[model samples]
Target: MSQLGKFITIILATSTLALTGCASKNKKSQVMVAPLGVGHGGNMGGYYGGPLVNNSDAIRNAARNIQGVVYFDFDSDAIKPEAARILDQQAQFLNSNQGARVQVAGHTDERGTREYNMSLGERRAAAVRSYLAGKGVNTANIEIISFGEEQPAATGSNEAAWSKNRRAELSY
Candidate 1:
């Protein structure tokens, strides 16, 4: 063979080896992707040859076992006395389970504009997250989301319904 032929063969072999190396990498060592608040933990490693576990479901179920809802007054992000009690329980669970990741979802009544409601929702969620962090829960493990009036606990346009709608819910 000519010198050019030999050089071409070597390059092809190197490229093939590199591609094979990439394709054969261990999937177990790779991090798994989950939802916003669900961190990459638990038995998340699985591929065609391994057993796959539903980690997001597991995390959410675990978190659901506690007091996961806190109510707020109209147009207020302030933590009420009752809300503080609920947060205390949530914080204790989070502190005990350091690996647990929590998502704080804030919601508002439909009395305001969408933009204003969204901002209020964010403040409510942030307030809950802050309270949990103050109680020694890791802030990194907490995620906050604002649903505004999009997700309401109650459907009617009355004070009773609005009162129920103004709240934050926790999920893992």
Candidate 2:
């Protein structure tokens, strides 16, 4: 081979080696979670950093269909009667799925002080938690986190937006 050809071959080998090393390093840094269900597309469906949920698409769809998380009138922690039906469905799902764990995240609209909003969020989450616990779901399997007014589902100052922001979201 000519000198130029030898130089190009060396460069290609070095590039290939560098790419291989980087790939191996990434593999070492990765954390793996055991999946609970098969993916619909036959590929793993969970994100890398977040917690891996059981990924029962049917159960997920059912949970999504139930609307437990609700907006209350401003500065109130009362659970509406309409919201109760949704929670009842969630309670049933949890009761049936013995191995499942869930996190109830409570959020509030930006109409109050941050500290006050945090307390309000906690109250809302606790209310749901208490209701679920009352419905024979294990208290240990449920975790509650209150984000207060820090994370808004909607980003506007109007009542319409604020109403949307105040809610509890369930995640597994």
Write one digit per residue (lDDT tens) for candidate 2, span 87-171.
Answer: 8888998998877777676778988877788778777777787889999999777777666776677778899899988888777
The global Cα lDDT (0 to 1) of model 1 is 0.76
Model 2 misplaced regions, further than 4 Å: 1-62
- Candidates' C-alpha lDDT: 0.76, 0.71
Tens digit per residue, CA lDDT, model 1, 1-172? 9999999999999999987776555643112222222222332211122222223666667767788899999989999999999999999988877777776778899899877887898889889988998999988787777767766777797999999999998876
In candidate 1, position 77 carries an lDDT of: 100
Candidate 2: C-alpha RMSD after superposition: 13.5
